[model samples]
Target: VNEILDLLYTNLETYPSVRTWVFQKVETVYTLDVRQISGPQFGLCFNASHLHSEKIHEFLYTKLSSKLERDTLALWNLLISLLAPDPSTVTGVRLTKYRKGKRKDNTGTDAVVDYEMDNENLEDGGKILDHEAEIDEMAVHDLGLITVVCQYLCHIASIMAHSTNMRCNALQTAIGFFLEASNAPKTVCELLAHSGMSVSAATTSRMLGPLRSQCEMKLKGLG
Candidate 1:
């Protein structure tokens, strides 16, 4: 475990500056049984981050007890980085040629949805204006990526569900997405599928029993 941590720690000595943002989601319209009409869209982003290695001993000043938290945060960091733009590889508007600020800021884990890669090694010519048309045609299908994003949503939801904030940010975010112009039910499936997690809505409903009830109680308190 120590050896593994040593290696991983060596890789992230410098907090990554790359940004991964989903520029668009590919929408697919189809019909299920009973002539059910549905329109599903996917969330896609262009990443611009890479990995490197260096010394570790200069960083880990604490003992091994912090190993678990360190590893978990490390994994999350790496995972988010993987969603960013890789210069030598990823090209086009996917490289944040015209975006601004970090979408993941107040968005919790939405970094993967709209990360504007830091302009460290790249030149910012007038190309920013040319990106509109290229990025306007955005939409991707990667359920695995969506799954990770959903977890962030769930985490935020769970937090807001219990927090004293009468206005639930997490709940609001979820509701905004689910209640927006998109197909709510199918979007859930799209996100979960991308993450390779399949827990039926029935199962989810059941799991939400306690949370849902608690939320209702809170809502009532606001009155």
Candidate 2:
């Protein structure tokens, strides 16, 4: 299994056939029928149990653990290109030909400047603009990448928790702890738990117990 995963990972970008097959498999898994739980408020909701049987965690550990989190730009680009193969596609907007900026005119008034890329690389010809369109586009791309990464991580964490009672779910655990700190309702915790965004309220209490005890010990010493 590890050998197969390694081969696929190594050849993911090197070979077109491998890339197509891998992406198709990924799409199939993503489209699997999972219980969609909705609440009054609009938020991310997904059933982790549906993905528990899937080998997403195995793929993640074997293929992506080394670099996925560190080099998200590459993942962002890959995802964008895969989802939007054509430059005119919706996701392809991230591939901008020009870097927008600002320059001072003869009258000292700031004018918008578009630094067109000569060959997919930005050249220093004008002062880079820090506001408006460019920043907004960048912000959108960053958020999209973050959302994708976090959701996948959450799925892996939740699956591990279900299959092996694993406590290595730092992302889900953090969300659970945050909910605990916020004194969020048990119903709220349960809702997020179904979505794999957090552990259940009971699990959160168990996880927080040691921390609470340590805090109490420190308070006593200070007192």
Candidate 3:
């Protein structure tokens, strides 16, 4: 399991040709949709656009929550779909995204079935086993949207980019801050400021405060 996960975290593509647009927003609840133009692959075309911090943060906080089951096919599909494209060996690839319905689905989001076979030709019995559960992300026009897989990969990359000592020091810093407000945790403001962030108290209390709690709750639930 560990090896499989590591393969996914490292082999998955960090960037793809897709743009996310905010579709509907009701109060704090947001429904984001993705619009993609798939060509040959990464080397096929060039569409360079920046990602929106606000949107991507929202996606990570909400979608990448603890709901992801490590033992199930959800992680498998996500990692496999995000796997680096190989136009050479891979015969064909199909991506199917399931939309939100009346009741919330597995992983608490839509599922995408990513199909891939390595046969030289599609005629032979080269069908791969079908895995389940998937997700996507949101962004603005002209700018590219980060896929859900890439988003999680980015999180992993951030940790991998740090040295062992750097990671330890960073965790120690986080622990210190976490212990500081272990009891009556404030949403943002002083805590974040003390952590060397430039977030304003008002903004933290009104906006990020809730968002922080949401992400924390999601993590706690996963545990």
Best by lDDT: 2
lDDT of 3 at 80: 45
Q: What is the lDDT of residue 15 in candidate 3?
A: 18
Give one digit per residue, the lDDT tens place, for model 2 in 45-111: 2233322212222333324333333433343344445544353342233333232222443436655
Candidate 3 residue spans exceeding 4 A from truth? 1-83, 88-90, 95-146, 162-223
The Cα error of candidate 3 at residue 77, in Å, is 23
Give the per-residue lDDT of model 1 (tens digit) for 1-223.
8776456545565213211111111111111110110011100110112101111112221221132124334333433555554544444344553342234555656445544445552455236425655445343323443555545533432232223232222222333323332545666755653333333344333434555565677899999
Per-residue accuracy of model 3 over 1-223 as CA lDDT, tens digit each: 8775455446546212111111123211211100001111211111112212243223332233232223223333444466655644323422211123312365676554444444443544233212222212211210232354454543432232222123212222223334444632455546644443323343323333454666787899999
lDDT of each: 0.35, 0.49, 0.33
